[model samples]
Target: MLKEDLKTVNEVSKLTGISVRTLHYYDEIGLLLPAELTESGYRLYDKGNLLKLEQILFLKEMGFELKQIKVILEDPHYDMQKALRKQREILRLKSERLHAIMALIDEKLEGDEYMNFKAFDMKEIERAQEEFKEEVEERWGQTDAYKESAHRTSRYKKEDWQNIMESMNDIFKALACHIGEDVSCKEVQDLIEAWRAHITKYFYECTPEILSGLGDMYVMDERFTNNINQYGEGLAQFMDDAIKYYCLNRL
Candidate 1:
């Protein structure tokens, strides 16, 4: 490739609006590496690297971790065109869901009692849940709890899943109410315990390890963070800290 066709790390960072630190970290993780290194020690990325970086960002938006993205990219049989098509479809569905949610909010503001039922309608929620489950399975399918949870939830009735979600939201909202307090405080720890118990009761047993991982996911995954933060600002990070404290001290 022509030297003029290559972009330096800083140039790529500026063009993509991604931080240089993140690009360096991606390089270190083998998720995305520069196409070449100049004799003067500058990292240069050609168009191919830029294309791979685009794929990496797309998968990240879909909640795929760097490791998973690496595996997907490294797979010889991976089809970029097919993956983009799939991503487009998923984004379309998500856009439609967001539109529905906005409409529901407007209806509620207008005092439409009958329209309230649409807010609780579990069809789209359940579909999104299933998609998340599949993504988790793809990422952590080897874990026993992942397998067990999949099997158990597959048998749940629509109503059961709805109740489970409602209970979870209640716990999240309760935790949000204590967001500014110490995470290790009795009230917050008790809520974390309740959250753990809720998971263990409905899904597979949530061991300390699982609980800790779930806490990390709450902060690391945008979907979980957005959902929890809907109750209050910073609630997801607060809940994560509370769960970690509960595991360390209470468990």
Candidate 2:
């Protein structure tokens, strides 16, 4: 491709209003790879890359997390046009909610009684959002996973949960034992698969995609990070790297 047909990462960032660091993160996650790399080591984006980045940002606005966005975008049959239309329906629901709130403001401006607070109800809006979430789960491969997870967990008693937590902690602690070791090492990779199997046995079938998402969450979600780190300092990051290595290399 002609060099003139590609824009440097900086230019793409400027045009998208996405910081260079964020763009780099997108690349690191395989979310939005640049179209070309110069011999001097500059990343470049072509028109197709720009379009994919737009879809990524739009999905982020629709409340899909980075991992979810990655999965959706990486789908073999992913249709940008269809995904846009689906998410637009969600925006339409939000717009209707805004109109309801606007009517309440107008009533107050006109000196009408407004203490009933009926317009402030968010049940409809929340339901719409939930339905949209279900649509995503259904369209993706996670609907059965969610349902199976819910069914399996609903029967766990207090002690069962306690035992489960113990096992979970043991796995993390075992993983923590290998801190500073290569994440792709056989021991670490084994631990990672053990982790995946634990989730499937107790929760639901943890597919590689779902497992990968949980790996990202280990560091991205503070709660998960803190919980994992309690097993050992930096264990969260270790778990993240180890799981990521397992997913990318050993899967």
Name the top TM-score candidate: 2
Candidate 2 lDDT by residue in tens digits, 1-251: 45687899999988989999998877665567665557896788877687778788777766777766765654434556677776677678778878878988888899988475666677766776677666776776475665565556556664575577667778887988999988889998998999989988987788888887777766765534655665678998898888778888887
Candidate 2 lDDT: 0.73
Alpha-carbon error at 132 in model 1, in Å? 17
Worst 10 residues of 2 by lDDT: 70-79
Residue 5 alpha-carbon offset, candidate 1, angstroms: 39
Q: What is the C-alpha local distance difference test score of each model?
A: 0.72, 0.73
Q: RMSD for each model, in Å, please?
A: 22.2, 15.4
**Model 1 lDDT per residue over 130-239, tens place:** 67547544655565565566566556664574577668778888888898999988888988888889988876788888788778867765544655676789998998
Question: What does candidate 2 score on TM?
Answer: 0.49
Candidate 1: what lDDT? 0.72
